[model samples]
Target: MTDQPPPQDQPPTPPVPPGNPQPQYGYPQAPPPPAPPQPGYGYPTAPQHPYAQQPGYGYPAQPVTVVAGSGGDTRRGENRTIALIILAAVVAIGLIIGSGVWYAGSSHGGGGTAGPGGGKNGTATVTGGKEKVPANPAADVLFKVPQPKTEDPSVPTAGSWLSGRVYAKSGIAEIIGYDPADGTKKWTLKFPGPVCAATERVTADGRTGIVYQPSMPTKTSRPGCTQVAAIDVRAGTELWSKSIGTGEFATQFRNVTVSGNTVAVGGSDGGAAWDIGTGKVLWQPKPGDGCSDAGYGGGPKLVAVRKCGTYGNRTLSIQNVDPTSGKVISEYKMGAGIEYAGIVSTDPLVVGADAGHSASGGSGVSDYFSIDNRTGRLLARIPVSGDAYEGECDTISQVEECKGVVAGDGKLYLATKERNEKKAHGSTNEVVAFDLATGKQTGQRAAAGDSFALFPLRMDGGNLIAYKKPPYDKGGQIVSVDGASFRSTTLMELPAAGADRDLQTDFQPGYSEYRYTQGKFFMAEPNVGKPIGSFDKDRNLFVAFGTRD
Candidate 1:
């Protein structure tokens, strides 16, 4: 039976009715059972009644059209641009090898037409895990937008930027935007308290805006996080901010995410949805509602997982909600001793269920399950076949961290690490492709060298981009894997670092991570853990490896 809250008490057995009153005096009445202990820690003990769909607040009858903007290099000087282009071409010809498939009726058929910046005119097809690489990826580094000056530089909001070259980074007190091309100040938006997380994207109105949440000064104090705001991307002004009455602990909230014009914010207590353009609160979880962590899925679908029952046995509700109205559209239930569920993807609705494996011993694997977001039916359960070595479970934020697991070109790619007998330490990383619909392993390939593990970056031009795992020294190289044939080709070796120091492993602003967006790749190399002073030389830079414009 679906778990529900204990029924409410009936009005105190209306005083013994006249005739029965005499008999009641002789016979002792049973004392009423103690009311179920009030819900603990704000979470509801009972299941929430699925709400009916209603007209969405401050939304149109039809879906709004969202347009993505383009990004380009705005040069600081003509000489510098020309020099970089020439250097890019030289590097391409020397380091990059063709994938061996070219268009018809061209003299440079196998090689393809190389633009001035050394990017190919047409795509290349290669088998055996090969990639078509450009000559000089560093030539695309337009400029490095520096982090802003603040009183306390220790804490920085996870920085994000728009394709229009508007870069944003937050300090404890404020969030600031900058032009990436010339290091010019675009705008700054200050909050009453510290900013927790920030996300920005182009809106349906053809403008960019940022949704940011503020953290409480004292974490122990109740109600540390009560509000979130939308800031104009270019103007650096607040459009509107709304307060959620969830007196939840500040640490429980995830970063704000923007899907279309709607922004969703989730916390430990519950979640709230708001129209980004207007500050109208669409719908929020009422007190004692079991639902938490509301997030946007594909289309008008909003997805969240709710938990009930007690420690040992728990039931999870995967809810598909209306994004605009915050009404529960459909619910799919999964229980039978499932305790924790982490969301990996939302479009086809991929969720990773923790099988209660500790990081210490045993397989320590997570079971990946795919569900149809619309129908709320289980599609497939991809068994855990890989060991928890290289590409294994790290704390969840989805693709950003575990670049090893990716969904692209109608297929799912996963990188697994296995213990190698030959090696004294370290394991071998292998790439496995699976059919998304069938959950069948299509092909498996190992990284070229035994020394380094391959971390799948992002898909570019219908190809998978992967790189050697860190301690990324001079020998590290970037390889592109073909989507169709599963072929991989060495693109280029990484530029030499300043010096080899203790490698920082944490994923943070100054830490190293590979990111691909808008036909460009960024490798964050920070000067932390070095001899650099705390303020003066504590610089963080992103090396933009990009294709020719």
Candidate 2:
């Protein structure tokens, strides 16, 4: 019973079509901006990065690699990236403290050697969390490039860089020296054009941060041509720029992130990196590839979800890309019932939601896994509980009524889906929370019509954020739960502002159930939900909507 709601007169996909109208999501639709279709619950290759991964889990032993080059995901949700050897990984050190295990070497082992500009010595820290960033992380070396010279200080103005926020209280968006605390503007700086996506990266300096902005493709005739701009948090100006794949024919940018002085990106052809300051091309493969995955962010190391040619009747390829040189270091293929779910967290590692084919090859298997970027390892994995589908009476068709799993912090929390079972049995459905850290059952809750599986809210400061769907009579308040203690609290109704509303409106209501962090919390509204995934701690939890000049 996939949580997909049946549209008006839309033929229900396979198995057993639910009896009546779309059950759970009781929502009205309005003409909004046309939304990209829910990313086929996948990217063509593997998973894209925002340097975020699913949390509450362990790492995987296997790496997901396809031949390479990923594209497609109208349903591409708000996935972001981490960048610079001025790396986010070092900032992510705060994350390892909670894993309950500290070792002499990272699962990926002595991180990959730094590429050009990765530091005169080569190599710096970057971040990726969505995939199983295990032992062999793609080289947390977000920067092999050297740092740039300081720019002449100037008055704050539009285009200057701000810390994390996009605009100044003065209503001006800076390219550098913009402060998040106030609307202070810095120098006049325009980031690279047609910014496709952007995010905040923690730098070596307390006041310094990195932002990666990808521009729209131009009408050129190159194969790989794109620009990645690195801005100074204190000054809001361009530190450097690198031309990625040709921008003309291939305009789609898979992911852009900064790890220290390095800026990595997965493009329509392959993954590439540049020294944040020197603007040196780090690495490039002979044929080159777009990236293995499409939803995660790109940095020193990039995990791609690719479709290696049809072999053995399976098509998915998962591999790690060296963003700097564009060389693929690790690769593996995904087959048999595995489908890209969504990102769990952004820093420390990458996370994913994957479904396996059932015994009948129809009923899907729901499990979650965490990846260590360096090793391409699976840190943790948790399968859904049997009772997860036990509620519905009568043989509920696997199709038309199956609910899957969502990952965050090593825990694969799945909402219960039993066809008319709750109503038939006069019982409420429940949500089964599985602990992937130890493959143990933590708890469960009674629910009704568990439709679109709600994902984890987010985890920070050892606290996990999530939403309590209404089927169980729970308020849609943003709930906070202690990671170790499993304590829960209702934060707020969260602001539904920004483009998220537009995206949400595209689907039936009963399907969405995510609780995460992106700062921007208010005492009166301490829970302003961001549109994208925010897993790393350095990422300031702030609020933002489309901006106006």
Per-residue alpha-carbon lDDT of candidate 2 for residues 1-549, written as tens digits (9 for 90 to 100): 012121112112234221111111112322322222212111111112121111111112223332222321211112223111100010000010001111111111111122222221112221221111112211110111111111211111111122344332111122333333342444456543323323333344312222222432234521222455565554445566555335343333434555555555543233445566676666422132222233233322344444321211223334455444434454334433232332333233333323332111122233434454445455555443222332111011101111243335555455443333332322333334555555444543323222212324334444444443332222223334434444333333322445333222322222221212332221111011222323411221122221111
Candidate 2: residue 507 lDDT (0-100) = 20
lDDT of each: 0.41, 0.31
Candidate 1 structure lDDT: 0.41
On a 0 to 1 TM-score scale, where does candidate 1 land against the true structure?
0.62
TM-scores for every predicted model: 0.62, 0.45
